[model samples]
Target: MARTGSGTGSGTLLCRRNIKLDSFLKRNTERAVYERIRTYEPCVVISETINKVYMHVVLSDERVYLTEYPPRALTIAFSFRRVRDIELVNDLPDFLSGKDRELCQHIRITYLTEKPAAKGRDWLRRDKREGLPPAAPPSRRNSHSPTIIRTSEGYPAHRVQGEGGTEEVHMLPPTRSASWPNPESLGLLKVPHPPARPPSKPPSLYSLSSSPSISPSPSDQRLNIGESAQVPRRMGSVLSRLLRRDGGSSREERQAELHLYAVSRTSRLYLHLQSSWNSYIIRSTLSLDPLYRRRCSVLSDSTPDKRLPSISLERTAHLFGQLSAELLQEEISVESLYLLLQELRTAAHRNVALRRLFWRSSEVCVFLVQTLEESLHGCQSLSGGYTADQLLLSTLIVQTLAVMFRETEVEAARHILLSAKKGALASRMLLALICDPELQTENQGSLADCELQALLADYLDAACSLLFEMLLLGQEASRCSPAENCVSIGWILRVIQPHPHLLDFLSYQAQHVVLVLSDLQESCLSPAQCVLLFQRCRLLLACLQYNSQLAQHLRSHFREEFRYSVKLSCAEEKLPLQYPISQPTLRLVEQILTLHRKLHTNTRALTSEKGL
Candidate 1:
């Protein structure tokens, strides 16, 4: 009978006073229900009653508890699962006293009942006593029609007293007369009447008879049963047809076609990039920068005053539309489009400012994924199934998923994979890329070698970047609780655990980064491509040294590579880049290498201590 404080430990106790009673009881009831039902927590507490004050408690999770307190405390529980219906009664009959009437705000709950008669009985039986009655001839005018039976109050009977060589026939819509049918007369047993419909709704067309408890008039009987049945059928057919028409039965197919067209459209424009330089406008006039590149690639939304550009799916579509028209008149390079897409993909992956822009305009990401999926599938099929284009697109999808996952949007990430029917398709591409031999590409000539190695490197870089993001997400969990950290770290481990080759590939990529950085000293890369390669290397080195799981595995699986990374991390100098690197890029590389050294030193010390 004693009630404690609010379940939230808020110190407030529920009061029974009239002024606060209803709200108090409602809130407490909701708390109680939520505590009871953990899996399917109640969505909302729709209605509650406390008129009798101790009569009942309704909680949001569809449980009702009746309680009595003070004198003899008792509790009874009922769930919504057994309930047939709930009705709110606001009116009181004239016979009720004022106080009783005022307390009539209680709800009426009905539970489903098991009716015995409904399951076990054959309600009607035909009497069989043969060879006794003599036949009576029918009258001339009524010979073709069946005999009609009527009782005194104009109710119809199933049969009348008539002489004939009798035969029993079961009939439809058995008549109910002034009195219920008896076993002696027709071998009929009593059955309970069906529940009546609420008076507010119009009569149902599918109900057993058109009129209720009354025989149809002569004129009404003239309308045939077929006509009545067809009325409802026709109405249903029309409604279904309208729904199908409005929803467009070919919606999915049409969407695929549109997505394909968009990809094809972009492809045509991009192919113009490889064309003769004189065919188009020069690069100086265009804003060819990847949007928010530096801000997004780094983990900082550090600048409060910076305004990140807002790009939506609709805006991207509109831009494509305008540009496509311009491509007809003058040459526009595909690099601009690629840079925007790259920026968009980056923005979707990192820092809150760009992420907010992405979430505000989600459809653009959706369309981008769809276009990529369709385009990648087409490229795979046309190129006999393992093209650079296909592998690149698959990596883009994984990159997009990583971004969504980083934002803690697991469902959004799942949807993008499933939505295009490319969930398995992307997996196949990744698997093929992994298992495909590198032996053939080496012999294909320098042009082919550079192209294939670059593509493979990009793919590996993307995979490593996703792993880094996953570890970053785990780091974010430290702000919450130890349990959250376990879950976050566990998720990262589980994801990478399946792809052991991913770890192997990252190990290879780390070594390749060392080579690429050495190559950057001699070979000139476009600024954008150069920036991307540096970022990839930084991410690879950072993830290898910092992520406990990856770092542990790397040290075991690729010991020599791990030792080299440690040496690079510990060395008190920078690997010089002869091909003048930008100040920002140089600074980022130094920061990453410094971080790697610090993390590696700490981890090595921890390992030695653990061993001791």
Candidate 2:
């Protein structure tokens, strides 16, 4: 019996050991298999790693998507049944190419077909699912014990373990998205930082127990960048459509619309510029850029070949078209025209090389002149309402002309005086006012018409008078070279012959006398070469036969000078005189007196030799 007992004991011990060893081996084998299976399971790549795959387990997603299939939620459950121990997910991905490996590391997929369990709507609530066990009912707890608020739920909704561990706190966020009040109405909101520790005394409702709420200050608040400005915009209706591309707009199909948009924008810019009158707008609003300049240069009959497809100036003929369209309306203002001239003058002054610009550049001068000419012409015409713009422009243009042409260095005054073959408009306006006793002959504003004379007379006289101070002023005023002066003077003299009554055009009574005297004086101012001046003046004076009284008055006025001139002529001839000194030039006054005395005595002899 002792022997059998010993044998039984050994068997029993051995069986126990065997059972334990089997359990151990099974556990090890299972762990090894789990590790291997984990390699094949789907995972996500949290970051790039040489030989590792890190992923976040997405439990569920409520976001709706417009697509064929609902996205599968991922979980951390894994198994390693197929192979021995494996360390990381990426190490096994060596068999995969770049994209496959990326896919393997960046996606979550379940290997098993079993669907994931879904949580109920109370998933976010703490009371039923995440809270501690409920406190004992009143019957179960003694009233004396502190009222422990134990909840029947499983675990605490929020718990802090250590620095590395945290728990979620459930509370309302200050701003609940778009439903929140406007940041502006709230006024300069300030965010308060949380205290280091909660107050010993529980905070009042006003005191903050939780993290401080953050509110951006007024300045820091986001601006609605693309919203309409405070002043409501007057949007042009989209009666037209334009092509769009890549969440933007396209101009290809909407050519007309695009052009319209451009025109509107440009027109608006012009109006804005006009209204604001800012220098920056003036400088950059319209570029003296090629387009504007070319538009200015466009001519009515411009040829396509000669036209630059896009240049800054226009052909001279088309200048009228290119002016700021706003200015072309029924009533152009004096202020506007003055401003325009300022712009032109500014451009000319600023550009030193304007001549190279050719035809268009010349148009600047032509444009200005024509505008002034037309405006005045218009104001004087029967049709125009006689706006003062023309008169104002005239004033400005005259001043501009003086400034612009003063540098020419040419002495054109003499040429001007001599070229009065019907006279320039400026000259005519002056003369018509002077001679027309009623002056109502037509189209003459006494104000504008008469002012021209005062300006020219004063201007010429002042210039000549200044020369007198310089000691170069001659009694008659002709320092001009005969060569050039003759061209203009000959015309003046010739015009008078064909148009005998041209003298009526002189602006002042004194102008006529001055004209005659001027001719004589210029001849004397430059004696030798201008000798023809005297001859011309003499012939012109002789043409005043119908105005004999006026002619005789002139002769009497220069009587002493005339007497000396004739006597000297006769002396030079050294000839005996047959008649009196007053007959004509080249006659001696002395001979006239002597002949009168002799005629008185000889009258008795034969009723006077003169009577014969």
Each model's TM-score, in the order given?
A: 0.32, 0.21
Where does model 2 exceed 4 Å of error?
1-334, 342-361, 381-389, 410-487, 492-612
lDDT, each prediction? 0.33, 0.26
Candidate 2 lDDT, tens digit per residue, 1-612? Answer: 000112321221111122332232223222211111101111222110001122111110010000000111111222111011111122223333454433332111111212112134223234464432221122111211211122233211221110011112221133543222222221112233232333355322112101111111111221111121121222321100100111142212110000000011101111111111111222222223444333233222123232212212233213323443434454767687787654443332222112112122333444444565565443463543333444456655543432232111112232232223433432332222221212232356677556654444433332222211111111111222333222222332333333332343322332322333332333222211122122232332432322433344434344344334333333323322221111121222333324334533443566555577
User: How well is each residue in 1-612 modelled by candidate 1, as lDDT tens digits?
Assistant: 112222321111111122232333333322222222111101101111111122223221223332222111112233333333333434432223456434323233433322111122222213333222211122221111122222343423221110110111212223632222221222112223233333343321111121111122122221121122121223323222322333333321100000000011101111111110101111110112344233333211233123133233344444434433442333334445444455555444332223323433445445544545454444444334346665666566556544444322212222233223423423332332232223234246677567766776666556554554444434333223432123243444544445535565655755655554442234444443444444455455555544677666655554544335433332212332322223334454555456555666887899899999
Clashing pairs for model 1 are 313-364
Candidate no. 1 TM-score: 0.32
Best by lDDT: 1
